[model samples]
Target: MQTVVQAAAWAQTLGLPRLEAQVLLLHALGRAPHDRAWLLAHSDDALDTAVQATFATNTQRRLNTEPVAYITGQKEFFGLTLHVDHRVLDPRADTETLVEWALSCLADTPSPEVVDLGTGSGAIALALKHSRPDAQVCAVDASADALSVASANAKRLALPVDFHHGSWLAPLNGCTFDAIVSNPPYVASDDAHLAALKHEPLSALASGVDGLDDIRTIVRQAAQHLKPNGWLLLEHGYDQSHAVQTLLGNQGFVNVQSRPDLAGILRCTGGQWPTVK
Candidate 1:
């Protein structure tokens, strides 16, 4: 009979990081993943046979290249605990930077309208709604399955974001927003890093040959959807900052700029649509 401490340590041997092991173990015990301190305090507590079996299954899933967030079915982003699964790309801490930038753009505007394209799991839209309750938030996705997951998240979180199911900007035809933001598919189709992320949905991970295909589509269409002087922000590949900056400039966006993520990598770029003369 293995105790909580022993089971967690053994899980680490399965090639999981220490924190992943602890969080999964805590989840199996019906404890919160962030309650690692509780696990330490109850170190000697013996896991029941059923609990051990569940943890073993979760360990095997992790070893099979499944993401820890998917195994646990929850990811914390922007201080919001979001429900995530295989239907959408998992949210990352890096995305919080885009959300912060969007919030800053809306700071002076009362009840600004914001739209998140390719919302995936509704991480960005929900975060913005949670932060600025006065903002009218909307999220759009191409996959109906992904939209289902995002809608469920909104319902559970009580953050009322209008969910639309269609390609980027398609569902919101003729609708203009005060700001538009997205963390679109920016990974190149042939990127080697994709091998490590084989478990995520391919459509949510890869774009076209140069990984800027979707970004190009967004830049072209965003001009019509963004109100004059409205800001458009996008999270993109770390190395594609220059390409993205040029794309925005070519699209007639003024004040074009790129922002570095938490690690100082230029990860998000944005610009403003001009006031129509």
Candidate 2:
């Protein structure tokens, strides 16, 4: 029988990061992902044969560059534990910046109306609703499959975000919001990094040749949907902030600015729709 410690070491030998190996091992053992301390206490405990088989399969999946969240079926985003799978893009920590910025905009506006475009996994929308319970949050997704994942997460978290299925702001045609936020597909279709992201839905990753296709659509449509003085915030690629800010400017948005991600890379940009134009 392989011991718990031995199994983790074996995973490391196969090139998984130490943290990933430990996380996958704990998952296979049916323990919480954060139960690393338990592993140390039970290092010598024999891993059941069934657990070992599960670990091996998940380890190979990780080796293929599949996101750990997909293998485990859950991801922690903005303090909410969301269920995820191949149907939706895994939520990343950087997206919290978008949520934070959105919250900041709505801080003084009681019961502000907000909408999230391309809300894969409902991470941004859910985070906003969870943080500002008085806010009316609506989320839109182009993919029915992505909506399935996002809505499921909302149900589980008991967050009552109005979910709509359609491209961008189309479903919210007659509605206007105090804020509209999106982390749309901004990866260039031919970017070299796309080769490493084969496991995620391509529609949720790549935009046009320049990666600004979705951002442009949002900036153009957002003007109609946002109330005067409303905010439009977006999370884009590491280097797309300037271009995104320009799009907002051309669309007559004001106060355009960018915010950095955890790594200090400018990852999010936003502007307020003019109160007068």
Candidate 3:
């Protein structure tokens, strides 16, 4: 039976990245990173067999280009550790920019009602709710499987959010909100990224040929769902900001603008619905 230190060293020798090696080692020992030393001191034959099995699975999946988050079924976003799988797109740091924008918009509004369209793993909705406990937050996804994952996350985090299984604004037909935010499928169908994105749900990543299909639909429809003076904020591809801004402009939204992510990429665009006359 190999000790935890020995197993970790072996995984590293397999050419796995340093962080991945640590994760695999922790999985092999059936312990978290902090517990690795404790498991090493109590190792036995049965534990060794379990460790070997886990290592094989982890190594094989990594070789297949599966994301470590999907492999571990977890991802961290907005300082929150979220449970995730292939059913939903893994939350990325770029999307945090949208959350920060939402928080800023909500700052002046009292008890704002926010809707997260196409919420996956409830990352946006949950993060918003966590920040503004008094705000009314609702999230909807077209995929039942994704909704399930999001619901589970909401429950685990004890964050209150309404989860619905339907496409776009279908579930909230008669409802209106003070703000609407989403990181919709902005990747074009012909995008080269899809080849590497095969491990994730296709429906959650790519849209129509131009990749603006869903974004277009959301832009046109969101105006109706938003209250007077409410805002519609969306995260799109870095290069798609111009197109998204155009879409928001044609929809008659005021104060239209795009914000850059930490990397200075135009990542989010938003506009305010005009107050009724």
Candidate 4:
């Protein structure tokens, strides 16, 4: 005797974000996630017992602070619907800043070779491959489970990307890329925000105490792997631009610059690896 209208109203009473509640409800009802307008048009429609039970379960999960993307098992990033779960961190729209900057760096180069380090869900690598089919794309990650998720995404999207199983820049011996990018773990070990991200894999969300451990690793090693004039783009915490820019400069990167995200926060930093350096 449960109805979609009643369920939606109950969700509102719980103070759940309208979009998250509807997404969970629609997923429970086996409807498309984008069909929010459909729900509005048919709000009065009744749902069967089984559908109601399923929706209730999802609503409770959301109430417990589970991410809507994790509940739905999919996140849209850079025009691609990426399947995500606990095995990988949910791709964030903010990370698209790195992808956009990477594309700009490779715009004039023909058949540019690109590598995404610590590619959690293959989001960055796949988006680069999808947008520039002529470019050769490679994704490297240390977690086998994460690699499996990313590999599946690449296959499902029919995007050809070389998948490597190892830590950042480890497996690509003697291989150089025209552009290297990553949205590595930039959250500090003591950052208060880690509590909110409890469900995500910590290895993919936190680095050393300063949160720049991995960035240091990537910047230090990039000089050897990057072709002359190659670019390295990374997404970091909003307040770490100055620190990251200094790291890039210390590593011999020139024309270093930080790009502002949609919120005007300098969330991404990049620089060119000059041949003379």
Q: Best by lDDT, which number?
A: 2
lDDT of 2 by residue, 123-163 (tens): 99999999999999999999999999899999989999999
* Clashes found in each candidate (C-alpha, N, C closer than 3 A): 0, 0, 0, 0
Candidate 3: lDDT over CA atoms? 0.87
Displacement of residue 129 (Cα, Å) in model 4 is 0.3
Model 4 deviation from the true structure expressed as Cα RMSD, one decimal place = 1.0
Model 3 weakest 10-residue run by lDDT: 39-48
lDDT of 1 by residue, 94-211 (tens): 9999999999999999999999999999999999999999999999999998999999999999999999988898899999999999999999989999888868999998999899
Candidate 1 has which clashing residue pairs, if any?
A: none
Task: List where candidate 1 sits over 4 angstroms from the true fold.
Answer: none
lDDT: the better of candidates 1 and 3? 1
lDDT of each candidate versus the true structure: 0.93, 0.94, 0.87, 0.92
lDDT of 4 by residue, 127-245 (tens): 99999999999999999999999999999999999999998998999999999999999999999989887688999989999999999999998989999999999999989999999
Order the candidates by lDDT, highest first.
Answer: 2, 1, 4, 3
Error of model 2, residue 24, in angstroms: 0.5
For residues 7-116, could you state the per-residue lDDT of candidate 3 as single tens digits? 66666777788678777666565556445556456544334576677877887788788887787778879978799999899899889999999999889999999999
Model 4: CA > 4 A from native: none
TM-score of each candidate structure, all chains considered together: 0.98, 0.99, 0.89, 0.98
Question: How much lDDT does candidate 2 score?
Answer: 0.94
Report the candidate with higher lDDT, 1 versus 2.
2
Which candidate, 2 or 3, would have the higher TM-score against the true structure? 2
